[model samples]
Target: MKLLIVTPHFYPENFKVNDMAFELQKRGHDVSVMTAIPDYPEGRFYKGYGIFKKRRESINGVKVHRSLIIPRHSGSSFWLAMNYLSYTFFASLKSLWFGIAKKYDAIIVHEPSPILVGIPAVIIKKLQKIPVHFWVLDLWPESLTAAGGITNKNIIYPFEKLTKWIYDNCTTLMIGSKGYEKSICNKGDFKDKIEFFPNWVEDSLESQKMIDVPKLPKGFNVVIAGNMGDAQDLPHIMETARMLKGSNIRFNFIGDGRKREYVENYARENGLMNNIFCLGRYPLEAMPAFFAQADILFMALKDTPIFALTVPSRLQAYMSSGKPVVAMINGEGADTIREADCGWSVPAGDSEQLANLLKHLSTLNKDELTQKGANGKEYSRKYYDFTKCINHLEKIIGTGL
Candidate 1:
């Protein structure tokens, strides 16, 4: 099958879409990507890319067509909206041109966020007369408010209408969490279209180099290794660290985000320097070793109604790394951790419960901890392997998942 994946982020941007494209290509499908210029996280063009440079490229034999994208200089809602709108406009225009020139069996729109990408995907679907598989990685409107990106309810109705319009057009709508099902099913006639398609760990996860962490303290390290942004609810995690002060457990935060300084400052001001170590950042390749060294992997999110229906990608990565997790997140993601018997979970923002869970996990012997990690690894392999994920995609391409 000739498949074109439409997304705002793609290869060289460090997203699961890169691996998904690779897996599709590995399966002998002709996979081409249509995405924006790489400007992410730091919100600047990457070293070699500019607004005008390198518009076309190929990765691992797969062709990538990059559309015009404006770098996000600030987190202002207006700029962010322009970023999404301009990317959607240009990507759709370019894709329509590409659609007229080339034919495809299916089109997969990797909707990680900024729901407007569907506008182009829908246009191309109608023009090309092929299946449009909308892979919704995040829920809109709700997510915008939940992530603190946009909070004005008066402005949310348009997004809600747009979200339903996009869903109504797609041949297959795939969601990463079952928690999303109830919300999406409430939309018009979507019951038969929506399917559960969980995210998967990278195929190269085992190849991550074993880097040493010389500064890491020698105790049970509860490692939280991802973006420390607004959604992480880091204040609660810091409070948990403060509560666990004087204990042997060390909280290692190993990522960069908007709230990194806040977390670091809180740790310092409260004399939690020893209890919580704010290690800045690590390359993706270095993550496996960090997880390997951790006695328990830690994850958190703000307690929001929308977040309860979401699962952070790190859950799959933690499980794949064969590490037990202590997840202080909301609903389905927490339920998954418990169901896998991987580790414990506490309600988001509940410092006391998180602290207690940590103490309970600390009481368990190393062998018991290893068993939990092993269970998580086996569970990830059985349920969330990329091979299985793409095979499901194949079935969906043939019919629908």
Candidate 2:
């Protein structure tokens, strides 16, 4: 099958769609990606990419088409809107031309947020008369209010309409979290079209050779890997670190994003540097080694309706790393922690509870922690296996529409 994947983020930016495209191509399906220039967590285009330079390239046998987009400078809401809108407009224009020139059996919209990415796929579907399979990893209008902090009805109503139009056009809607079904269905009668398709841990993360990261402080290391964005509830995590000051527990943040500077600043100002360590971002291949040194893997999400329904992609990676997890999250994410019995979870934004949980985890014997980690790994293998997920995705694309 010839498949075209439409996404905002792809290779060189570190997104799950990169793995999906590679796996699809490996499986003999011709896969091409349509994406914007690489400017994600840092909110700037990557060193080697720009509007005119390297716009079209092939990576690992998959053809990639880059579109023009405003970088999300400072990751402010206004800039984020521009970044999303620019890609939607330019990519939709590209889709019209690409749809005619290149024939594909299906188009998959790998939407993590800014659901407008689906607009281009819809355009291609209209032009080529092919199925548009939308894999929704984030909910719109809700994310605007939840993550972007946009509250005005006048601001949200148009996006709500846009979200519905995109959903209505898709031949199939693959939801990342089962909890998303209710919200997506409320937007339209998509009950029949919705399919539960959760994220799998990246292949790189699953089988990486461990190398030492000497920067990690020697203590009860609580590693938080991945994006340190607003949705992560970094304030609560920092507060929890503050509460744990003077203890042997050391908080190691091993990723970067919009709030990374804020977290660094907060640690310095609050004099919590002793308990907290900001290790910045590393490539996906480096995660296992970091996970290897972690006493406990930590994750958190803000207290919001959208977040409560979200099962973060990091959760699967954390579990797959064979690390006992600790999360300050609500709803579906919290439920997964409990269901997997891999770790403990407290209510989102509850620093006191998280601090207490971390303290308790520190007291647990190595054997006990090891068992929890083992449980998580076993569960992840059963449910979040990459091969199984890709097989399911192929089946969905084959039969959808």
Candidate 3:
């Protein structure tokens, strides 16, 4: 199968779509990616990427075409809007031209957010009369209201319409969470087209050599990896840390995002520095090493209906690391921890419950904690296997052998 993946992010930006495109290419399919200049959590173009620099490159065997986009400087609402709109405008134009020059059997839109990425795939689909598979990793309008804090319907209505149009035009909708089905169906009659296509643990994470990180403080370490953003509910995590102060538990944050500075300041100002350690972001390959030193893997999301439906990608990574999980999250993510019997979960933003759970977990012996970790590893293998997921994707895109 000849496939083209249209996404707002790609390699050098650290998204799951990178793994999907590479895996498809590895499976005897010709896969190419259309993306923007690498700028993400840092909110600035990567050191060597820009409009005129390295616009076209190849990674492994997959061809990559990058479109010019405004960097999300400071990740403020204004800058983020510019970043999203720039990609939609430039990628759409690129799609029209690229669609004419290149032939592809199907176009996969790797939509993590700003459903507008589908505009380009929809354009190419119209030009070539081919299938457009939209992998919906985040819900629109709801994310704006939930995470972005945009409440005015007058402002959100347009995005809601755009979201529906994108959903209506796509040949297939691959939802990252089953909880999203109801939301997509509410937008339109997409019931027949919707498929549950959850994120898988990266194969690299499964086999990592432990590398030394900043010496962790002596105690039961709770490693919180991934983006520290509004959606992550960092405020409550800090509150939990404060409540657990003077205990053996320590919260180690291992990622950077919009709220990273705020988290750092909160820890310092409140004198919670001893209980919290902001280890900062590290390369993806180095995460398992950090996980190796953790007594528990912590994850959380703000208590919003939209977030409740989200099964954060980090959850799969943590479970795959063969570590006990502790989540201050609701809905799907919380349910997964319970179903796997991997660890404990508390309501999102509930510092009291979270602190209490950590206290109890600290009391558990090494063997008991290891059992929970083992349960998660087994469950991840059974349900979130990467090979099985890619196989399902092949069938969805009509490329199944």
Candidate 4:
């Protein structure tokens, strides 16, 4: 089958879907990607690429069409919206102008918001008479609501109406967690279309056997590696660090985001210098070593009403590493931790609760720790494997075809 995968984020941009696209190609599908030039949270074109009209190229065997974007939105909300809108605009135009006529079995769009690419996607689906499936990585409007950024209910009605339109139109809706399925369906439509599309990590046994990886700085290391943003209560993490200041426990933050400066300054000012270590973002490929070396992994989102439905992508990575998590969030994340018996899930934003969990984890014997980590790995292998999700994708495409 021939497929066109549309996303604003793709190769050389450190997104997981790039690997998934390659996997699709390897499965004997002719896969091509339509994307913007690599500029994400940083808003700067990558070193070799210029900002301009669309450029076409091949990476490995997959064909790619890269379009130009505004290229100036890293942290600011207004610019970030502009950045998203810019890619969506150009990618949609390019898709209509170029991709609409192409013969393909299906169109798979990646999303937090695939709305920009959706225009051409819908166009091609209409013109070519093929199915277009929107693969949702994050639930929209709800996530916006979860962040507490959108308070205007007056505007929400129109946006909600549009969201319903998109939801009903897409041939199939794919998401990462079952929790999301319920939330999306509760909107009164789209109940039947939502399906779990678990994210995957490639086999790590080879690398684990290959060499002795670098160890962490020292002591009981708990690491949080991913976006540090408004959705994630990183300030609470600093507060937790402050509470653990004199302990042997160390909290390592490895990722970049809009809130990096704020999180950094809080630690410095609060004198959490002894407990918290902020390492700037590392390349995606380099993340495994850090995960492998950590004593326990961690995830935290703000105490929001909607986050009760979010199961962060970081949890998948943490599960794959065979390490128990020290989670500081609620709802879906806590449920996962409980169901898998993989780690402890403490209340969000409570430094006292977090401090206790951290100290308790330190007291656990190696064998107990290993068992918990193994439980997480087992749960991930059974329920969150990408291969199974890809099979599910193939089935959905088959139904549509």
Highest TM-score among the candidates is held by which one?
3
Q: Which candidate is the best by lDDT?
A: 3
Tell me the TM-score of each prediction against the true structure: 0.94, 0.97, 0.98, 0.93
Kindly report which residue stretches of model 4 are placed more than 4 angstroms away from their true locations once superposed: 52-54, 204-206, 209-215, 399-401
lDDT per residue (tens digit) for residues 275-310 in model 1 = 888887777888877787899998998999988988
lDDT of 4 by residue, 30-84 (tens): 9999888887666688777766433787887889988767775665767766777
Candidate 4 global TM-score: 0.93
Look at candidate 1 and tell me the lDDT of residue 45. 84
lDDT by candidate, in order shown? 0.85, 0.90, 0.90, 0.77
lDDT of 4: 0.77
Clash pairs (backbone) in predicted model 2: none
Off by over 4 Å in 1: 74-76, 149-151, 207-209, 212-215, 399-401
C-alpha RMSD for every candidate: 2.0, 1.5, 1.1, 2.4
In candidate 3, what are the lDDT values of residues 255-366, reduced to their tens digit?
Answer: 9999989988998898888898888889888888888989999999999999899888899889999999999999999999999999889999899988888899899889
Per-residue alpha-carbon lDDT of candidate 2 for residues 68-185, written as tens digits (9 for 90 to 100) = 9999999987898899899999999999899789899999999888888888899889899989899999899898889888899998999999999988889899988999999999
In model 1, pairs of residues that clash are none
- Report RMSD for candidate 4: 2.4
Candidate achieving higher TM-score, 1 or 4: 1
